[model samples]
Target: MSTQPEHGADKRRSTSAMAPRNLARLCLTYALAGLAGYLATLIGMPLPWMLGPFFFLTAASVLGYISPIVPMGRELGQVAIGLAVGMRFTPAVLLATATLVPHMLVSTLYVIAYTFVAALLIKPLARIDSVSAFFATAAGGVADMASVSKEYGGDPGSVAIVHAMRVALVVAVVPFLVFFLGDHGTAPASTEVGATNYLSLIIALGLAYLVAVALKPTPLPNPWLVGPILTGMVLGVSEILVVQVPSFLIIVAQIMLGTWLGSQFKRSLLVRLPRVTISAMVAASFMIVCAGMGAFVLSYFGQMPYATSFLALAPAAVTEMVLTAKVMNLDAEIVTAFHVMRIAVVSSTVLLVFKLYMRMKGSEIGPGIQ
Candidate 1:
């Protein structure tokens, strides 16, 4: 009996010692990862402002072989921004949607075709699975790609890595293109905050939140945010109110999104990532090709400028793309249209494809393991 008590005491002591050691090791690891991510950002990586942290979390989950469903904080920032824009849709915008729907569909086909080509190219070069390649080439935002990747059986680690690289490159590269390739002469003077109407903004937000909550049961991404904004915009155009999207709010949203996203890098993972850079480049080229085609098609339909179409087609965040349009003095309406359309198209297609794939495989692709 005495010997049994001694054994129990030793076991408890062992657990007590292991707990702090494990916690300390994990903290050190995360700190190193955060440091690496910050350094990568400093050296001119395009790290999508929100997608980066999500990627970091995803990678951590994958490495630990933990459940890959990590909560994304940056997504909240994106939802807020998306909701704000959704609120900007006036009655005129809604009316135009009738015409835009067909156009969006046509453009969607081209986007899908382009995405397929991206997947085909990535398969041979990336050594990643087909589903991962599909999401990687989806021509949507980095976070969107990650979400879709999870929907299918795609590797979360690869999706995170590919998305982080794409955002970094696009952010670093696109600004230069805007400065040089954009119509500097026609760029509008910056929006004046003093001229912004606060009552209208509040009304838009309130209406949007209400609509969003109503749409919560659906699988639409961030329905509470996107749905309400869309409804608010409709109301705005219907003489319910005149809403103004202020520049300061947009900037604050972007910075908050960007800094939080940028913090997901770990030096060790990055060092391992160099091996995957070629695959990422190939994937990026595939995305650019899709964007180029989208630019041409959207231009043909909306008669929107190429820069506006190109930004929309590029798989960057909607808020970031809109902000880019603002900075370049491009058309925000066109930017929003293409971005929203891309999300609708990709979400619907990916979900349908995943369903069919799971049915065929006799198992849930991205669902919890049996």
Candidate 2:
């Protein structure tokens, strides 16, 4: 009986000691992420706050320089990003892009086909199971695809790594390609903020947070992102509020997202999965080429700018592409619409495709190529 009190005291002491250490680690992680973002900005990197921290954190994680705990503030960061995306959806912008729905549908189909082909190639080169390769090659959001991969008997970690690499490659490469290929002098329009704007921004954020929480239990792909986006779109379309997400908040979101993504990489993974990593990079490149070709086709037939078409066709994360479009002064509404359609279609059909593949293969469930 006397031992019980000592045990309780020891547990309490350990907990008290751990709490401050955890807090310090978290603060250190954010500071490093923020520094990386600042450095990227100084060098004129595209989406510096995001890409910078992503690269930095990935390297830091692999080098064993940072703790692996995901920052607690990451979800709030996502909410901020959702709000930013939502503000772009004015009724005029929606109406203007509505005519492109057919085109988006066709483009989405092409993206699916391209993803399958890439998966087939990676299966042979990487010796990954079919389900894993399929999910890894999918052109959906990384977290969404990773989560779905787990449900479909795919290796979620492998899928996540491949998806992260794909998005990183697209984010790093597409902007430079667009800039060199198209006019770069035009600047994106800026919004002026007043006191009323701040109030509206707060309301918009609150609505987004509430909606995201409500949608958490749904079967939606990326409910956090989708919920807030839908809420923001409604607000925008209804003209209930005209608000701008502050630049600082945007940077914070980017840092959080980047850090989260970076923490997904493990040092052991690099050593153990070199073939998977290299093959994923190759597959991603093939997909990018396919997207570029499709973009060229769209440009030729639709008489649209090649840069805009490239952005719409690129299989990068929708948020990343939309942000890039905004920065490059491209038609962000059109780009966002195309990506949303592509993701929706891909998310809905990916499971069906896996089932079909399983049926065709007679349930052996072996490594696809080896």
Candidate 3:
């Protein structure tokens, strides 16, 4: 009888000791996952390697949701992704408007309208909330929309699903669209650009890291609209000023963003996979239809060719869209602009509506947490 009490005491002591160790292990796992994800993207992974972070972090998050291993929320993720997007800006990107401002504006407005249309159409089919539908249907990348959904109190799971479907569908479909539509005489990327100067690459990576760290402290007023893209753009313009920003560094950041986005796919996240899959398909198809409409308007205003503009409207990552534009020798500037505009419009609209709703409800609004 005395031995039984002694054994129970030992068990309690061991459990207490194990808790902190397990937490340390979890943190290490997530850090490694982030690094691995970046490596995978560098080696030509179809998706971003940073996804490794999302995957493991998601697992930790789910565990925390049930018991508290790591907190699961989208705020930090949103800010990171947003800051990366802000880095995409430069004066040249704005210059796309010189001859095509009216057209670009029309195309942008069309895409915004189409997001609502997609929400309306897909709602009946997917059996998800209209806000969820709106997010999924937006003509922005799946990752961006998912982040916005979390910020606006929409269903993150559903947003993740729909956004994934849009990206997968577009990536699958757009290559063929390019093959069929691209001008037959178009040249592939120059061999000089591909030769890979190692010294340049190292310098670029260092700069990317520095810039990413610096931007972390900048008060990003609605980073989802301005962070990553603006940062990229500013740095890009610096290169034109003879500051010599390496191209490889920007690519590294892009890869990081992509990988991080993928990291959301943890085992625990799988629980809701079935519902997410269904919603994604319905939302993607509906959004595609809306993109078609946007393309028509862009064609009318910009007098830009229909194929490239349509591809711009296709729901995918800005990086992919811009890369495709460069490959097909289409106007990459327009593609980037449309992408940035879409995120800005969608995030702004969602936040505005959320604020109004909260105000009307007269409930407490929690400021976003880091």
Candidate 4:
């Protein structure tokens, strides 16, 4: 009848053996992230909540000041961003976005094609295998590409690093580039950030989280984000629940995303493969330039702003790009739509491309891939 020992064991298990230490680390990480976000805002930085924490933590992680990480931060951020963006899809906005489907499709293909070329560039520059290079160069989600690379016998670590470097470069550069171009004026936001209805927000987030849980067994790429977005779109378009996520919440989400992203920077990875990292940086930079060119073409044809077009076409760094669009007063809905479409197309076709290319090579999967 004595349950003291059993309860004590349960208490220990709940601690996770180092709960205090882990909690302290997490608190410190978040403190740094919060300070960085605030400082960014004070300094008039573009996408400050994201870029500030991202750059700050990135340097900290690299320089051994801290190894920043936030568990479940990415998913939480995605949900918040997804809901925020989903509210932008008014009937008029949706109608306008629909008109540019063809242009977006072309841009998506252009991105994929250029990424292939980037992969080719990586091969010689980094001396990495084809599978790793290809997956790394592709502009899909980093985790998604890395997983596929593993399946295709690619170096997942390399894929992750290259993708990380590419993401960091694009995020660090694109917003500033657009800012310097004078396109980042105080443009209209997607939705008005009205007085947040705390009750409504809690309900909405709860539903979105439930939706994510339900969709977890499915093949959705980013259910946490996608689920909330879809839900928000329905509610927004219907005008049934016109609630706003507090600015603080959105900033918190950005901090979460930035923290997780910054933590992905492995100093060891860079040290171990300096040439490969450099090659990835080069390829990423090249892709960014190509995206700029594509933006001009798309802007001309689509009759959209050059900045909007550019963000829509930018490779990798989807959330950051979309956030940039929002911050710059660009067409965030269009940007979000374009990124979603590209992810869908890439997720569906990338594996097929790799498989077919392997078949075309005949007999073997290529030493680069192997």
The candidate that achieves the highest lDDT relative to the unseen native structure? 4
TM-score of 4: 0.88
Q: Residue 166, candidate 4: how far off, in angstroms?
A: 0.8
Error of 3 at 47 (Å): 12
Candidate 3 lDDT by residue in tens digits, 1-370: 0101122333443354358756665456545655765665575443333333434444554464221113211223333333333334456546654566555565666666665566666666777765566666666545455666666556766766666556655654564565575432243233224455466534443444455456555543333323434544555567531122233433444333433333333444445556666666666776676676677777666666776677667765555555555435566556666666655565556555444434554545435422
Go through the candidates in order and give each one's C-alpha lDDT: 0.57, 0.73, 0.52, 0.78
For all predictions, the C-alpha RMSD in Å is: 10.5, 7.3, 10.9, 6.9
Model 3 has an lDDT value of 0.52
- Which run of 10 residues does model 3 get worst, by summed lDDT? 1-10
Q: Which residue pairs in model 2 clash with each other?
A: none
The top-ranked prediction according to TM-score is 4
State every prediction's TM-score relative to the real structure. 0.65, 0.83, 0.57, 0.88
Error of 3 at 315 (Å): 2.6
- Model 2, TM vs. native: 0.83
What residue pairs are clashing in model 4? 129-368, 130-368
Per-residue CA lDDT of model 2 for 1-370, tens digit only, reads 0101122333443355357667677678778888998999899777788888888988887886644334344567767777667777777777768878888899999999898888778887888777878888877766666666676667776776677668767876787678677544354354443434677888899999999899888765566666777887888778777677887887778787777656656677666777877887898899889999999898786666888899899986677676667656677667877887887788788777766665665654433322
- Candidate 4 has its poorest 10 consecutive residues by lDDT at 1-10
CA lDDT, candidate 2, residue 111 = 92
